[model samples]
Target chain A: MERILISGPADPRLDDFRDLNHSDSRPDLPGGKGLVVAEGPLVVGRLLESRFPVRAIVGFKNKLDSFFASFQAENSGVDLSGIPIYEVTRETLATVAGFDMHRGLLATADRVVEDSVASVLEGARTVVVLEGVGDHENIGSMFRNAAGMGVDAILFGNGCADPLYRRVVRVSMGHVLRLPFAHLEGSYTTWQRSLEELSQAGFHLVSLTPDPAAVHLEDALKGRDKVALLVGAEGPGLTEHAMRATDVRARIPMAPGTDSLNLATSAAIAFYERDRSQRT
Target chain B: MERILISGPADPRLDDFRDLNHSDSRPDLPGGKGLVVAEGPLVVGRLLESRFPVRAIVGFKNKLDSFFASFQAENSGVDLSGIPIYEVTRETLATVAGFDMHRGLLATADRVVEDSVASVLEGARTVVVLEGVGDHENIGSMFRNAAGMGVDAILFGNGCADPLYRRVVRVSMGHVLRLPFAHLEGSYTTWQRSLEELSQAGFHLVSLTPDPAAVHLEDALKGRDKVALLVGAEGPGLTEHAMRATDVRARIPMAPGTDSLNLATSAAIAFYERDRSQRT
Candidate 1:
């Protein structure tokens, strides 16, 4: 790893990590720099290991050292000599970020071309497709859960938040960087037809809902060789059109009169159930 | 339902819901008022149904009307005639709360005497015992997951956050108000002994962990008639002492090299597994 000692926060070399609190919201938008930022040692390390090309790293001296030591220990023979690591004091780093830096480290990477949905699904058995999940925290949590449960990839339908947003990346524990994901390009009809293609590819497209008529999650997933768990936002779950396009409607067996579980939590349960069916 | 149209935010009758951004943090402390504040129409309706005595309610005119309408329709016989509902304009309500109210409704209730762990455990098949799960949002999500998965009660061991905090109540979708919970009083040793007592009471004390050596969650939960899932915070999970006191160590099967799932998501999966075992 290449390390450089820097004495001041106002240095232009650190501009990529500056005013992060205000600048990170729409970095992926047109006319924006389209840079992805990862905070904390764990996330930065993951960014180092991901497909995205790392541009620079800025953090306090101790954090940068610790991150480098662990990263090198976990991954041997990977050269990070070209990446510039700027070392600054805690106060200097905080001032440049324009906020109290809780994690104390940040890594900026350029957004790469997304994988096509077909490519991510080439040999996958389990995947998650989200619709109208606008909350960054929920989207991030979903990625973390998907990674833990061994889901192959994620596909965004519509009205979903930017998975590359800083908050999503942080909340995802950096799994968003490692997980393969792509957006379904087009309107509602086009996505519905995409669901049809998935179904034709022998994937069991199951829409998760809280409706009493839906089958239990385990029963829906039982003996299925391939699965695609369809989910939506918390309050307004999968639309009628979306549910109609799937092969099965699965419910988690909730107590009467209780509202449904959080979107990510519900998806995790479904993923767990799918994993269990294969395990036994 | 008693509906009083109050015109201004400064009305003395609306004091229970004033400056909530700052006041709701430690309401259960000695120096605090020991009040339980519920925000949003859903949570406020739950507060009305809970055992805690209602103090007062303040909200915008339209939200209060809609809340009353749905509440009365669902609960035909419950009398809410004594509770005062202060209705105000959106601007006045925002000023009193010191922030823009996203849900546009709030209710306050007196914290009632907690039920003993034994009382809540009577005839219960599943319960969750938390230790060091300090985040309010996680606690709230745990309650909602427990309720949805048909877990009977929740018990706090050590280092857990205040479950009655406003953020928890809102995130829980009011499940915290409806579900029963109590803290295990005293030090770590006492709580460890309480775990032993729970075992003596014929409950299968299963500690949830990320340790690779632990048994799969389904294997641990299968055929257990009464189960108490012991969980810890995300990082630095359950203390060694706490896990030692349990009967078995359980882990959700995860992909290699990924960090463990979020605390509440892990708990939800365990709860769902336990519920699934009983269903079939």
Candidate 2:
């Protein structure tokens, strides 16, 4: 990594790191360059190790130095011959970013072409299919939980948010960068039909619902060879069209009169149950 | 409920709902009245159903009218004759609250004395004991998940945040108000010693950790009659003293190289597994 001393917040070299708090013009937003951003040293390290092409790194000198040393120690073989590591003071970094980034560091990566649903499903035993989960934090937590729980891929259905969005990356602890995810392509009304491909790939599509009539999650997943847990947004769960396409409707057996679990937590329980069932 | 029309934000009757966004002087914060606030209609309804004594209600006319109608419909025998429901325009409500409360309504309640840990554990078949889980969002999610998963109570150990914090109340979707919880009375270093009481009450104290060597959660929780799941903060898990005091440390077998699941998600998974174990 080449260390470059950058003094002014207005430097042309820092454009990728500028005005990040601006909703419309932030480099990572859709209206801007549509780049991916990883905040904090831990997430930035994950970005460095991911397949995405890194553009630049900007941070306070001391934070960058410690991060680089630990990153190299963990990944000795990483070749960063051309990546510019911009070393700036706290004031310059905060001014350039248009906010006090308490995390103190950020890295930008160009978004790569995503995988196809079938491509992401390859060599997978457990996967998560999301519908209408537009919240960044929920999507990020989904990726993190999926990675931790050993779910192999994530397929986004209708009304899902961009998985590469900056906050999603930060909230997922950068697991969104490492995890395999692909958007299911089609119109909103017809996108669920693509789920049949998952069925053809020998997946037991389990729609997670709060309906008491649904089978318990453990029983639904007990002996399945390959499972795809379908989750939806918090307030309105999976659409009837989406649920009808799945093989079975399963639930976590929540207490009566209580609201359903948060979407990510619900998916995580399914993932955990899927793993537990396999182990036994 | 007496529906009183308040035209001015400066009216003294709105004191309990004033300056809600200020960190120091918010009615719910330590420097102010230390009252419990319930935002949104559903949460306010929960507050009405809870044991917390209602102080006042303030909201826009339409939101308040519909909420009160449904609340009364749901609880036919409950009396609200003495509670004052302040009717104000959107601007007045926003001005009084010091923020644009998108939820459109708020309710103030006097903080009731919390139950003792021994009393909360009296008939609890499943409970969660939290340690050092200081984040408000995580604590709120813990309560919500505990309620949905049928956990009977929550016991707060050392370093935990107040469960009645405004953000916790909102995030828990009012479950924090409905769920029975108690603070474990002890100094920071000696709190883990209180685990003996749980054991004496015939409850299995299971500490949830990410350590690979620990028993799998399913195996650890299977066949336990009464279970108390111990959860800690995100990064540094349970302190050694806390884990040392438990009967067994259990793990949700995670994929290698990934970070542990979020604290609340981990507890929810444990709760799900505990329920699954007892069914068979």
Candidate 3:
């Protein structure tokens, strides 16, 4: 690996780490040169393990060495001979990242290709389908919950944010890179058809709703085998069409008059319920 | 009731509703005019029902009238006869509140006298005790979860946030007003003494932790009647003294690699488990 030392703020090679507050949003722009940037050591480690092509890692010398040691130990075949581990003082590092606290490490990698819906569902027993979950933090949190709660994959329907967006990645605690997810293409009809395909493949399509009339989650998932839990944005929950298409509409029995739980928390409970039932 | 039509933002009576962004934070400052503000119709209704002494309501004329009509129908004896209901266009109301979105309504009330820890715990079956939970949003969500999941009251230990803070109240969906909570004074010694009092009162104090060796929450709460579930902040968790002070240390059964669930979410799940076990 080419281990370079970054001393000053205006180094041309550190362009990938500049003006991160604003330019980070326009990852899809022309000449965007958008790299999957991971902040903090824990997330940086996940980025290194991910299939995305690692470009370079920049951190304090000691932190960079520790990261490299762990990276080499984990991946025996990882050829870091050409990769540069840039070491700079804490002040210089913060200036380069345009943040006061960088958590001692940052890494940039080429964005990986998103999987197709079919590819994500190839051998999955459980999946979470999201609709209109535009908030980046919520999307990231859902992915993290999905990963932790044993969901096989995530399927994004209409009006969802980019799962690879930096905020989403950060909020997901790097689970976005680990979890298998794909955007569902086509119109609402196509999305419905995709859900039908999952149903045909022996998946139980369950729509999570706050409707008082829906079956309680515990009762609904009591004996289900393959389940696809569908969730929507917090305020305007699942659309009527989507609710109608599911085999079961379930609710996390809530106290009367309270607003619904945050979208990700709701999804987490549902996923927890599903996992709990399977264990029982 | 005096129906005031305040078309201009400069009206002296509207001072309580002015520059709400900053005034709401430092409610104790001179000329601060601290008021318990409720946003949106649902929370406004809750604010009206709560014990807080409501001063007045400011909202769109249509929504304000509807609120008053509902209060009248409920025969709430809300003492609105002397209170003013400021009627304004949504735009003007938003301007007075220093925001473009006002959620169509607001209610202002004098802060109620908080219950003492002993008072809040009077005749309580299940309670939640928090420590070092200084974040308002987390505190608010905890209250919302506590109310929804059938917790009797919340007792704040050392280093807790004010439950009546606007963000906490808003995030809690006004449940902060409905749910009983009291702060403990003095040091960790005093907080420990309070826990001991709960124990003497026949309450089983269960401290929640992420330690793998701890008993599972479901197993721990199996037959406990009066239980006080102790929760701490997200990262550091409960202090060692708090953990030792409890009768038992319990843990939510989580997926192997995940750190821990959000503080409020974990508390909700624990509360849900207790409710479920008790009902069954």
Candidate 4:
């Protein structure tokens, strides 16, 4: 990687890293260059390994060196000849970022086209389908949990947030960059029809709800070859139509008065149960 | 309940809520009133049902009216005659809260004494033991999970944050006020001694870790009559000393190369698995 020395925050070459917190979330910015921004070495490393195309990087020399070392460790063979890593003073880096980035480094990647639901679902055993889960942190944590629990892909129905958003990337610890996700086909009403593909692919669509009449999550997944756990926002769970589409209305039984768990935690439990059921 | 009409935000009675976002996190504030703040109708309703002694209530007339109606519906039979419900305009409520509490309602309650570790463990089928889980939001979510999953109590080992802090209270959705919890007796080294009591009470101490060599989470809990699912913070999972204190180190299996799950989500999974094991 070539080291492009930076004197201050104003260099045009460093525009990809400037006020980065603003750029990643706003797709309507100039030229629609809303690059997917990954912060720190941990997330930036994931960004490098992801399908997203790297634009450039800004960091102190030490972090840049370690990133290269980690790349060498992975032996990813990703060509670095054209990727310029701009080295700057810590002060200049923070000023450019508009926040004191303790990680002292960042990288920007041009957003790639999202994969289709079918491509993400290829050969998958379990996937988590989300609806109305528009919170960035919730989406991020859901991706992180989905990755750890070995769910194959994540598909969004209606009212889902952009997974590539900067906060989502940071909160997911970069797992959002690694996890395969796609928005479900069609609008909310027709969204149910799109799930027909998963059903055709032999997925047992399990919609998680707070209804006591629903089967326990464990029993609901029993003997299913492939499963898609559908979850919704915290206050208002899956819409009536969304719930009606699922093969099973499943629940993690709760004490009498408590409301539903936070959407991510609920999804994590469902994912864990899915993994346990398959293994056992 | 007496409905007191407050003219503005400056009333001395409203000081409990003034600059609340700052005061709740700062225990050293003058007068030393660390009041438990319940914002929003959902949480305020939980507060009305909890054991915390309500100091007073403040909100617009509509929300206040609904709260009394809810109190009557619950039919707690507790005398509400002495508790004054203060009424104010939206502007006054915002000024009093230092920022608009979109919850449109607020209630103050005196902080109650915590239960002893022994009392918390009594009759607990499962309890979540947290160490170095200092983040307020994590603490709150842990409480919520523990409560919903029917985990009898939460016992903090060390380096944990105040569960009653405002952000925690808000994040837990008022579960902090309802759940029973205690800081383990004594300091870090001596805290291990408290585990002896749980052992004597027939509780299995299962420490959660990221080590793949450990038993899978489900396998680790089989045949255990009562369980304490111990979890540490996100990074630097349970200290070696903490891990060694458990009867077994258990892991929620992860995909290759992922770090530990978020502390609250990790504990929630364990609680869910524990719920599953107990039933089937």
Native contact share for candidate 3: 0.26
Pairs of residues clashing in candidate 3? A1-A81
**Pairs of residues clashing in candidate 1:** none
True contacts kept of 2: 0.95
- Residue-level lDDT of model 4, residues A76-152, one tens digit each, is 56666687789998888888878887787788998878898889989898998888888999999888899988998
Cα displacement (angstroms), candidate 2, residue A248, comes to 0.6
Identify the runs in model 3 with alpha carbons over 4 angstroms from their true place.
Answer: A7-10, A21-34, A60-79, A87-104, B7-10, B18-34, B60-77, B87-104
* Top-TM-score candidate index: 2
Q: Per-residue lDDT for A151-254 in model 2, tens only? A: 99999999988788788888899999999999887767899989989999999999999989999998899999999999988888999999999989999988
Best by DockQ: 2
Q: Residue A69 of model 1: what lDDT?
A: 79
Give candidate 4 misplaced runs (Cα > 4 Å).
A26-32, B25-32
Q: Highest lDDT: which candidate?
A: 2
Model 1, B141-249: lDDT tens digits are: 8998899889999999988888888889888989998988888775865677777667877999999999999999988999999999999988999999899989899
Clashing pairs in 2: none
Question: Which window of ten consecutive residues has the lowest lDDT sum in model 3 chain A?
Answer: A19-28
TM per candidate = 0.95, 0.96, 0.89, 0.95
lDDT string, candidate 3, B118-232, tens digits: 7888899999999999899889888887887778899989988767777887999899989888876658556766687788888999999888899988778998889999999
Docking quality (DockQ) for each candidate: 0.89, 0.93, 0.43, 0.83
